[model samples]
Target chain A: MSARSWNLALGLVCVAFALLAVFVWIPHDVSSGVIVQERGQTNVGDAMAPTAWCYALGALGLLLVLTSWRSRPAAKSAVASGPRITAANVRFLALLIFMLVVSLVLMRYAGPVLVALLHALGANVTDYRSLRDAIPWKYLGFVIGGTTLVAGLLALIEGRIRTRQILLALIAVIVIALIVDLPFKHLPLPPNNEL
Target chain B: MTLSLYDYVSIGLQAVFTAHPAFHVLGVPISMAVVMLVAGLLTGLIVGAIPALSGPFAMAVALPILISTFGFSAAALLPTLAFLLGVMKAATLGGSVPAILFNTPGTPDAYLTTFDGYPMARNGQAGKALRVAQFACVSGDTMSDMVLITTAPFLAVFVERYMGFPEKGALIILSMAFIGAAVGASAIKGLISAVFGLFLASIGRGDDQTPRLTFGIPDLANGFSVTVAVVGVLILGEVYQAIEDLAHQHRSKTSPSPVVDRGDQKLHWHERLALMPIIGRSGLIGITVGALPGIGSTLAATLGYAIQKRRHKGAVPMGQGAPEGIAATEAASAAVSGANLIPVLSLGIPGNVAAVFILIAIDTIGGLNPGPSVFTLNQHELNPELVMVIGVFVIMMLGNAINWTLGSMLMRRLGVLQHIPPRIMMPLVLVITVAAIYLQEGKMTSIYFALGFGVIGYLMRKMQMSGLPFVIAYILADDLERLLRQGFSASGADPWFLFSSPLAVAFLLASVVVAFTMSRNPIGKTIIKNADPE
Candidate 1:
């Protein structure tokens, strides 16, 4: 278990999945109205003070993962034996816990062709044991023909109609969140002339 | 200071001799040698022979695989500037192969190549210090890509004729006084991490009206994403200190040895022309501290190995072995890898930290806005000389052909990176940095504001702070608050008209004598008292 108790249980499950996406899966907006004149009617994503600074940095990364899982140290004597682990560090820790469970389960149902099939499963986990003993059906045809040829060529260049690859990946994520929200558009200052 | 030096030297040499033509198949230049030099030299030898992967995680998985290979032609913008010049010369010679066999430091300019590359690999002269760090990283990155194609169009026509805006805000206050007196271990914690990275680059939402610090997170109204805050403060704050130093360390069972004395000793061409005058004084202090942003390439390879150990007064100085201390710290951090893309290719100024992800991939998929009119605009009308001559010959021949073919076969396959330990590589680089911050905003609230700036970049690198001058003053704080609110509405609010020109009164008198000598930190205790001279 130690590897700092699986990195303090994967940093306390990414601070309990960022405190259930800041208190029970996001959804706010009860007319901000200056966060209901200082914290009253709340809920506009809990009167968004950066969702309580993302639950105060996920409760300071859950108090540095419960003080690095209570200052580990306990196993100071036990596992004296050797060689038991290294099958290339358990295939690089099972390709780093299957790329953190395939980016917490395929980033909201396949966005970047499951992030380029997690970079072709990190180049088949750095030649997964020499392509699983050289061309064993080309490592199951590169994990079923390289993850269905990178999710059918990024769902046929994000189209072959699955609601046109989820409406062109949600209109390429609302035109890159409206060109990174163009300097947070307040605009009005000085140049106002009512046209 | 309206100098326009002949329209900044005829539009910076017609933006480096307008090159284009890369696409064509059956008839070569095959996508500029398979997507800019063989898939950027196999993503710079698997992110520079993986420590916990580097070269900004092969530019955050090659910028959404070149933003899903955006519409070809205009010579597929020279394979995204030849995959950022083969991940900046295979992450600077694959960060001196884990500072020569696992002392570790895959890149923070190979932390002074683990002080003389692990004492010349415990003196087995690790393949003659990895062939003298691949001939001083391909002769200091082909003499800093021929001085960034002949000195960045004469320093962009001398900063467009004697620069202004108080000498570009005293050259970002003397590049945050040489990144807070040359990086880390305190220059008042690197000017309080470049004033907390210019207050997180003046928190998003600003084009004007006013909301200065979006503490009211409207998904930081397009604020963050300086390539997701430089892949969340330099690769998700080094995967939260390699998952808290891989759960305070383990994996031992000894192996890394393979010393093979490459046919017994070689170097002497008069000991490699006496380390070319300390690799031309650390490639002129790595092209002037890599054209200064938040002074990068690990403080230009620790100020070019502290001016080649104070110009070698002789006696075996520079951390013991000295092949002119690995050719002045690998030719001054590979002469700021093509002079840190000459201010992100002529003034869309993202000076360092991989020119802030190649100025957010030439403003998100070369739509453009990298400054001095991305070599004079004309967007859909196209021809900005096809992305400034195939982004300068595919970033100087994909950074010297990935330093002459996989830079010495990824420095002799750096002992299969000690069987990838860091507890299965820090939760697989925090699950590919949460699928690159949800492919840059397919929001789970931008993965909850990138796990709230990955827990404020892991408590500002566990309080030692200095997240390289707060991620280069929060990626140039919204172009320094929209050029200080368009120089205070074109002058009316005249704070002495930001010091009436003369390059903004010599950048407000050298940023008030470098903010009064970096609020007296005395060059971080004289570079850790001459880097541990003990």
Candidate 2:
């Protein structure tokens, strides 16, 4: 697709979202009421500004679609139809998403230790090599294991831990523990007594 | 308007000599502000010479540290703000050093400087290019600061005295419309993005009285954390872009040609005289754009260059090697640094990420509120906010003076060729950003918000969206909503309350005219055209 088509598609999406926000997301009471008399309801019962902004966005999207469509036939091949999604881009994106999911899932449950491990490993993903090559594994397992141990011990000693090392370790632990706790469907949010 | 020239001078003297004895230090006798300015300038020179650590990025890293170290009250004091302002100026100056020597601009604004800067370097005038850049940048920035010293407080006082919530609301809307029309690919796209920002900001319940867009999520009851959103979207998104570039580089097989040249960096009096017009013209252009919400230094640099090129009539050969080109671009971009504060200090709208970070630091670390309140004079107790505001102007001049004296000397030591590998720096930056976010909010949910926003920011970057307007909208969303709501409440829910005041009416009308006119091609081609990406 040309840039115009892409813009049109984006415009359509904006229209849909804006319509939903204006009509569905805003509370019915605020929209219906003449005066919002509730405590701290400074608008006294006004929800129009948000709804007005949504309508304006909807209108803008419509205009964008019209303009882009009008320009579409003339929009021949150009140097910049925006960035293309190459295989490398896809791989980089996938790695990022994987890291994100892993970090989020592990952040609450395992906290510091696991998260650090993931980050340390995740750092290599930018190189577009194999996951192993992304990070430095040249030092072998003992080196990794020793550093991980010292990192964990330091976190344990500090009553209020906020280091990156602690962050990664906690993430790693939680992901592992959650896999083990699949049947129970329960997880502890870091520094907790639950196993 | 009310005060005499003597009263103003008296207040200025008092602000310097006796406002706070705590500021007194060293033999020079200015205060901690001098120390802060020197420290900030050195830090800026080092950081800004690195392509990855631009002024805004450095500010992002430093903000949490600044706040955490200084605490709220101490952070608001003259020294800390002065340091931040100093860093901002020096960073603008230092960006050109790398741009000249390595052809890798330290910041986006420096991208234009490389058009002539690199050519000059290739011509064996690397030191001269650096010197020209330093002089133009510092002088231009100093000029803008002087303008701010006059205009910001005047505007603030007017707003405090005459504008109510209704007028304020109208002004914010006007600002939004103007910024939206001025930036992005198109006015429609800009407006849509801004509205989207508002929608996103609508999420969360803050304090006790506001409505929450939580959608029944317990974790989101407190709203998305600003620290997370800012860090994730702005800083981490940049990291992702860098990583993406790395991925592409790994797939390609190419080698870079290294160029080496150095000389004595000194400026002749005649050269300085020759470059003054270009610097002055570009400075004016930069200050005009910077005082508004959306237009940034990149555009300013481009416009300045384009105009100066036209004026020169090809006498100096623009892209091949021209001192005028370097001067025009550097002066405009650097002028923007000081002028960017005009809106933030007066109207409370941050034009770009740097201003956003500054706003965040001021709000978090400084107990004082910005906007018209800073200019409000207490008839009873002599408002400290006003005193602080004036002191801030004084610190800014001191920062500019420091830049004039020490900036080029510091830039010489930055070693532009000794580029830090992204592989080494990117990971450290990521870790620092995450840790900074965690420290700022002290909540796990805040981390989630940051990560989530980071993803959004990354996607937006890939999609060719300008983050400036979105950030501006997001930052101003609460203020806009609050003002509108307050206006409605005060007017007993009257729908036309915005038209009640002449000021409000004027703002609304001006907004319509500006937005419509700016959206047109003829005007857009005239005003607010951004430079093409390198």
Best by lDDT: 2
- lDDT for A12 in candidate 2 is 91
Deviating ranges (above 4 Å) for candidate 1: A1-195, B1-48, B55-126, B129-131, B134-166, B169-228, B232-262, B266-273, B292-350, B354-413, B418-427, B432-474, B493-534
For model 2, what is the error of residue A158's alpha carbon versus the real structure, in angstroms, after optimal superposition? 36
Error of 2 at A162 (Å): 28
Query: Best-fitting candidate, measured by TM-score?
Result: 2
lDDT of 1: 0.55
Model 2 ranges off by over 4 Å: A28-35, A38-43, A46-49, A74-76, A83-91, A103-195, B1-33, B74-79, B206-211, B250-265, B313-316, B376-380, B516-519, B526-528, B531-534
Q: Please provide, for model 1 over A55-152, each residue's C-alpha lDDT reduced to its tens digit, 9 standing for 90 to 100.
A: 54455456546655776454634322210233444453344334333433333334324335656877434423233233222223213222332233
Model 2, C-alpha of B472: deviation from truth (Å): 1.2
- Per residue, candidate 2 scores C-alpha lDDT tens digits across B372-431 of 778765555555666677777877787778788788677766754336755435544554
Report the error of model 1 at residue B61, Å.
Answer: 14
lDDT of 2 at B75: 30
Per-chain TM-score (chain B), model 1: 0.34
- Looking at model 1, what is the TM-score of chain A? 0.23
> Least lDDT summed over 10 consecutive residues: which range in candidate 1 chain A?
A186-195
